[model samples]
Target: SAGSLQELLHVDIKVLMAGSTLRKVKSRSWKKQRHFRLLEDGLTIWYKSRWAGKGHSTFSVTELEMVREGHQSEVLLSIAEEFPAALCFTLVFHGRQGNLDLVAESPEEAQAWIQGVRKLIHRAQTMDEKERLDQWVWDWFQKADKNKDGKMNFKEVRKLLKMMNIEMNEEHAFHLFTMADKSGTGSLEIEQFVHFYKILTQRDEVWKVFQDYSGDGEKLMLEELDNFLRIEQQTGERSAQHAQELIERYEPSETGAMTLDGFQMYLCSQDGSIFKPEHQGLYQDMSQPLSHYFISSSHNTYLLEDQLRGHSSLEAYIKALKRGCRCVEVDSWDGNDGEPVVYHGHTLTSKILFRDIMSTLKEYAFKASDFPVILSLENHCGVEQQTVMAQHLRQILGDTLLTTLVDGQVPLQLPSPQVKIYAVGTDSFSLLLVYIPTFILYLCACRLNAHLLIASGHLIPTNSSKEKEKCGAENCPMASFALFSPLLQKSKSKLSRELSDLVVYCKSVHFHGFEHSRLHAKCYEMSSFSESKAKKLAKESGRDFVQYNTRQLSRIYPSGFRTDSSNYNPQDMWSVGCQIVALNFQTAGLEMDLNDGLFRQNNCCGYVLKPEFMTDGNAQFSPEKPDERQGYRPLRLSIQVISGQQLPKVNQKEGSIVDPLVRVEIYGVPQDQAKDETSHINNNGFNPVWNETLNFVITTPELALVRFVVEDYDKASRNDFIGQFTLPFKCIQAGYRHIHLLSRDGTAIPPSSLFVNISISELS
Candidate 1:
């Protein structure tokens, strides 16, 4: 009755840390007492109602982002007047999941749960593959131990195998069960079950590969290990020093040489990761001008879901900022309360107090990236509320907000995000109007101080310029940014002039032809492009687009037709050197994967410097005709699909077994796009092997992304996506590697991976 947490009485945690009945608070009017307990493994939490239930309700510590105490969340704050903040705590989860608000009977109890959960989360995060596997097995053991006797009989083992999507002959199952039940009690304990699991999940694939490399059929000498790395992994490096270090690190038992155990561990290490470990740190140059890098950005940063009927909350801003997004959109409108509100205007999307959003921005702006954030203001508020917006921004952001130009002088190019803590461009001031009559209203927003202000506006959903709305057409947001023009500045009012004078580096402008831009467009004048328009330009005038982005900042956003808040492939825009390719941060898909993959490096600072060819305004570069460009060298990439380890099962039916398949896709220039896949292995979600080789020719490696996809194959219907991992093509290391797969939402499904051999050579 006390639960299996009797075993959780570890030295670090107190005995009372087992479980407690805490009040789960959904709202101020609704609170229910639920019994909460941490499982014995310390990775999962289980909660139940007062009455006994047939099934269990649980949440993993891995799902949690962090735990905050004392009315830290809005839900907890709602009951602050009724309940003391000291007795309340909130569990913040990753992604779009809602927060868990709870109240303890006393402050001491609350601290116990909070500190206990924090410790568990820390342990879960630090666990290695083997440790994770052990916990996973323990979890299964808990599920199968129906009598709560800490042991499993033949019937339960058979049932457990079915639950794990494994169908085995009864005789063979019993034979293995008997082998594990060393005491001959006709039942197996936790240790016995672990041994049985090891027998069932024997790595035959690993043994074959090991036998291929190990000359003595046991261990490898230093030269033999070097040969394995050079010949089998295609590293082509014969070094005793590197081999010795690896042998020392992976080979246990003080063995001087590498053994099968060491080989297996090394194959699953950071050195064996598909993404080069050397690229994990702050490896890229960050000193370039802001425009010279591809910046991680989010469109409609207030909306949590689709544009229509979505709740606009500060959590969206927090999520984006925490994920290293440098550019965040704020659609400011005049609220009925005489304050500015941020939301999708004219739609059923909920509204949030603009000041609250500002406060969240100030708190989380530098948590993920120390780079300067671009606050893109889509102003719809009147002058009075605009002034309030300005006040709140200044008040909340304080010294972090960029008010004046760096060194108080005009900048030739936008400043680097790393060079300053925040603030850079001057064009953060003017062009805040919705209608021409409200031009002075935007001037009222002059009091606002931000690091970088990339301003745009829309009277309705889209700008009413007939030529601009091409079903999925692009609009040059010049009407809203009209005040920044030199001609408009001459006769504008003083308030207007105050804002206009502040329009420094990033003055928004309409993109005409390339010839026109070459002759007239200043380096500071940037352009915004819709997805379709940007794609068209990148296809028709790709060279010009690349050349244009070299000197000016270009932003590409999704088309208005994407009401579901779906994202376009950011790789396309990045290929054309678009600095700001904004996506719906609330949505998850292949597009966001590419965004995450590209920004996963360079300290994850939300900025990746463009390649040298794309950095010069005069450089001859074309994403379409990459083969013809200077220094163009096409490379051949070959990936050998080997085996999958501990992949997750999709179907929940007892008899269901997944037929797994691996697909490799390349996203890049028109000529370099390719896809290759392996045939499915029937009835095997665990340790399926297919030694198929997939090949591709990448003409523009710098702009390409390689994606590895695993799916549960079904001939009768659409296959279920198991997991995938995506990264820039150039980040791949040519060697034997393990690609750790990720779930649909991009979180790590630990211990799930694909073993492979990679080779890169000049295309012949």
Candidate 2:
């Protein structure tokens, strides 16, 4: 049967199924033979039954998670109680929550199956951008070929670009199509299509960078190379020796001079990889607790415009998820339809169907990063709609929804089919728990009760008592000493037995003050503070906030003043080790750019582990108190601003010779330090040379970002931003480096980079 199946399938499919065995397992009432096949993009499992005929299912490799031993084994054992002797090795599908247990005939056979599946998974996990791009091109070709033809025409190419959200001029598209159509038939084959894409995406700046140093317009002489290296060097007089070493390393022919191809290879080798191989350990530490990491989060993730009148679309979720946002917010309100809707309540924002949002979540959940997505549900629906909401979530999310503890703890029983939903009622005192699960659901008060709280302020003696009594009473306003005694008596009636079962790890409480967070009862507490309040707290009591956040999760969101849905600098919160620094995902600015840069490390998995000193849970460490630790060393950063290549023009005129200047900024705690050239070079956008050096004394190099901004100088008007580059100091290499400029929207401006030399040293 396997041999016959092999003949029916493609060569690549047969190779993946070559060593694996097919076994018969009972599905419902009928028995079926299961055959596993790996595709370029995903895995296919075919099932053939005697009476029920044949069926198959395909799963994206990104969605597949191999569940072995421990909790997985326990779940299998529970399932086996029904079937008695079913061969079981559980495979959990993320987001979809589909679980499949393959039955092996023997222990050795099961081991082989596990090994084979894991090997495929490992290959999928390590699939780099280039491989994914190739697969995408193939997939796009199939989709664009509407008639199932082997070739695509110019119309199909335009449709393909539209599908990919790429905006290209009609002339450029036709030109590219003509170039790819080698047969001159006005159509492109798959090979030609891929070639066209590769050429289109290829950076032409490599040749330009090479030609910048090439004196003869062809090859770089030894003396010219040496002088270039000397200018690139930070504090060295041995540029001649370094130049000799570089020539020996990159020189391909017998000639002493370096060719354009050889120089391009040297540049490619340096800037090719975003994450260096040596930085692998930074992302590999998954053993730590979830609270020990800073999670990339988005606030009001459904909104795409102004906070009060924005359109709420599923596109927002897709964009945020693709950008490595692990935590997303959903504001659910009961819709006119039977199902619930997600939107900002009390606003003119349009709503989207809850089911549609769930479907979007399932599709794009693991596309950017293969990590668990946290759905921060802000429920505003009534009990009936809440029940319907839970039903839809169960039907949609299925098993991918995390119900139990993922921290390797063995639960008393397997997670129930239903989710544990929690909601704060309109009355504010009433807490509703709709499902049966031991997991905790955080519920924050929607409305502010400043007037009521201020009137009853004296009744609440201290912030600690306020927290304790508020938890017991479930009141929006902190129960006062007068109200606390009676509330404690009536707490039994208000609190349900299900509350104990639901409240486990995370409990949402309004942040009172820094001192309130230091209390013992606030250990497992989670707090959401406005950005202004958080900044004030950080300034007034930064050390306390840092110590508090070291153990528990603290969320910082934009203040109410940001009606435009603009984002604040998340790096400020991150500097203090705040876990959830929520930003407006729709708006693109310096804030979101820094957010992208920080999470770009660690596979952009949305969760970056906090530094060791921050995670130690000791109050002794502080960014302000740098002298307390030996690891805190003063860094001397020296940057040489050399020249800009094909620098972007502010004005749209054809032959506008714009005046440009470079402004260098170092952002970190203690305050932001900046410096800029006093004068701007006029009449040169092609290549403006500064040949100036700047120095900065960094007290905390670990939490610093070096940002280089290019602006067009104007005497009559304000200077306009041409483009800028921002990156962490840790990733910056010491030598001749290229600073690639990015637009305000975080898109790369090709062939635009500031050539700079960097040298970092410790101050004795």
Candidate 3:
């Protein structure tokens, strides 16, 4: 039966079950025996019920998590509390906030189901560096082979690099093409293409980095290797052992020294490299309340340029998702083609079809990360278009879209293994219960809860019973709804019964002041503030903001006045533990660069667990109030600016030389600080050694970032930026380090680096 179903669905699926009775968690009705197929993209279950005829439901692999057979009590309790009726051998599948449990014939069948699902998941999770590189190269090759000739010419190769936002000189492009074309046929075959891609993505700087420590430019003895690993690699006491092991593993002879190839192998290994392993853990604690972590987000994610006149395209979504942005905004309006469109409202920006945007999202949603994507939908469409928009989203997103509460009941407390009830706030009604039909909830306000709601308009209060009756009976329809209670500051205000039923977990609250937020409900209270307002609030009450954000979700968006779609420095908000720091995805500036760098950690999964201090409700951490902590140690940083190699010339004109200078800047909460060495005048940009040591004392090293800036000095004008590299101070390794430079757009410039010696000490 599963084989037949696989052929029908046109997917390569391994059969997990030939027949089984499945019960809908929401309805508690058992359907007739059906076949289950595990597809590459998702799981498909085909069944027939008395009320509903033959049908098949497909759940995306990204949305499904397996719960082992014996470890199903907590899941069962979470589901039973929501849906009263259930049977044994039920395999529970968890989404963002919803759970679906399918009943199997026996525990053996359930274990088989779990094992099958996990096998596919394991394959997806174990994508190593080489596998990822291969996938990346293949995706680009497919895009570049517009003619579908299985080969790319020099022109196509150049276009591919440009489309990827990589800048390359024409001469360099020609040279690369010539080298990749092994047969001198002026085209790169698939193998040749992969060879070229490896060259572009490979880290050849390992040779140069090794030479910095070896001093002889050829090999490194055991002591030299140990010192390099201890100081530059930050390997601590095990540096000597690791060095000996590396030499034993990679050295060709008993010379007790490592060559260039040996060093490269060590750098590319799992235990020795900066790159995270492919199966790196996705999260620290999945059971923690969603409000406790910072989620990477993008503002005006559909536009490619200024908010006033930028081009709106599906490419924006792809780019943002690939960069580990979990939350993306979509501004929707009714289009002339009877379909909803997405664009910046009240601006000269162009529009793209909503269906096209959905398609792009489906393809690229989990490419970079497998976290839940929050679609911040700003709806400005008529009722008809609104229904159409909902239809498109449901059809395209399929089961990946979260549409219901996790346990079927409004959570009375924070999520814990025991389902323990935690006090929300001092408010009388900590948890409100109401009943409304799903369709009615959709019709009343498309703004789903934080997970998946359609926002028709700004939520307002209904004062009188007559007003409430009118709001519900006419504007909104209500039946039976189980939703999270809304926490409103105003004591006397009333809301429509239908509207109140839709506010499940994320309650929209207008930010009044810091004092109001401290006393508010923890996980249930949600607030959105403009970037400027948030920044001002953080500046005035940084500690309060940090404490408030510890247990609540705060969304900081771009200021309304930014017509050019410029972004604010997200680090300022991150310093206070603001969860959602939304930025303009199109703007490439220091703010975006910093955003990219911050999210680059934690496996680039877009959701990073807040620091222990930030998540502890009572612990206080403020950049301005460092002395408040009694045992805090100041971080002293020492950087020796050695030299630059193969630095790009600012002016491309012949006979022009760059007067290179190195500027080391430290950015943190107390204030921005910078120290620059004198520019080496008249020394061409090639390999100028300054030998100048710059030192800085940092109070908040955790929130600080060190920036290495290379500039071309000019006598009469502002110096031009040749390259820059910025990273969080905690991620910085000690000792002799080579800092690879990045272009203004943040793409790595191959083989370009600054050699430096860095040491960090804790001040007494």
Q: Write down the lDDT of every candidate, Cα atoms only.
A: 0.77, 0.63, 0.64
What's model 3's overall lDDT?
0.64
Better of 1 and 2 by lDDT: 1
Instruction: Sort the predicted structures by TM-score, highest score first.
Output: 1, 3, 2
Candidate 1 stretches greater than 4 Å from native: 1-12, 15-17, 51-55, 234-239, 421-504
Question: Which candidate should be chosen as best, given TM-score against the real structure?
Answer: 1
Q: 1-764 in candidate 1: lDDT tens per residue?
A: 12333444553356234678889998789998988887666677888887767555898888998989897776787799988988999998876677899999988888888887787777777766456667788888989999999989999999888777666789998999999999999999888888999898877878887788788898988888888777766555545677888888778757699887778878887777898767877888776887789999999999988998898878788889888898898887778989888887768998888898878888788888777788766665655776687777667777666655554444567666654433334587544422110000111121122222323221212234553453233423322334333332332312212223333456656577788888877665667788999999988999998888887788888887788999998888888899989999999888988898888877788888888899976689888788778789989998989889878889987788889999999998888788989999988777788999998899999888999999999899999999999998878888778999988888887778999988899977
- Evaluation by TM-score, superior candidate among 2 and 3: 3
lDDT per residue (tens digit) for residues 510-573 in model 2: 5666666566423445677779878877777777777777667777878767889988988778
For TM-score, candidate 1 versus 2, the one ahead is: 1
Q: Give the residue spans of candidate 3 off by over 4 A.
A: 1-219, 231-234, 248-256, 259-287, 412-504, 671-678
Worst-scoring 10-residue span by lDDT in model 3: 435-444
